[model samples]
Target: LKGQIHGGVAQGLGQALMERVVYDRQSGQNLTGSFMDYSMPRADTMPDMEIFSNPVPTKRNPLGAKGAGEAGTVGALPAVVNAVLDALAPLGVKTFDMPATSERIWQAIEEARA
Candidate 1:
């Protein structure tokens, strides 16, 4: 479920620093339209991820094994965003608005340049 991991992180990143879904006042429609119009995380934006967690729980029927699903997504969001910040730290780019689009990144880059 690489898609799930990626998608969850995308959602988390949206919640973290980007524009989230909100109602359109005039048309009463969703603000985010198509995938292209949407602000999404890009491939080069994130660093490698390290995932780890405690063993499956044992609370039900002597076998409380936790599901493997949702685990990766749970682990990936923070790691990816953290890596981005870490990469930009040396440039004094400490803050960002998310989904970290090229436009936003470009603005940050320009700000850093200034």
Candidate 2:
């Protein structure tokens, strides 16, 4: 269960920071058709995760089982986005678009300076 939670969190973090698909706007053609073009987070990209859980058993389940597999992911996505935005707040970067890639962050910084 602990491992499952950690894996979920890692996946969620990857989606937030490093996962995206590129496409050509005019042709609607996929630009990231291969792994070489598409970016995914490697083990080095993941942060050290400390997973903690408080089990509350429900009578609804016969065995009193609770799911923690996706809980880490569900909460991590928006939390990470908001954290990035918060970090950029001091630079007067108020708006955040999706993916929030390095280029986007740099652009936001430049725009703020302008």
Best by lDDT: 2
lDDT of each: 0.63, 0.82
Model 2 pairs whose backbones collide: none
TM-score leader: 2
Q: Over the stretch 1-114, how does candidate 2's per-residue lDDT look in tens digits?
A: 777787778777877877788889999999999989988767677788777778788899898887776767887788998999999999999876667799989998899989
TM-scores for every predicted model: 0.51, 0.77
Off by over 4 Å in 1: 1-29, 33-59, 62-64
- TM-score of candidate 2 relative to the true fold: 0.77
Candidate 1 overall Cα lDDT vs. reference? 0.63
Error of 2 at 43 (Å): 3.8
Pick out the ten consecutive residues of candidate 2 with the lowest summed lDDT: 40-49
Model 1 TM-score relative to the real fold: 0.51
Candidate 2 total steric clashes? 0
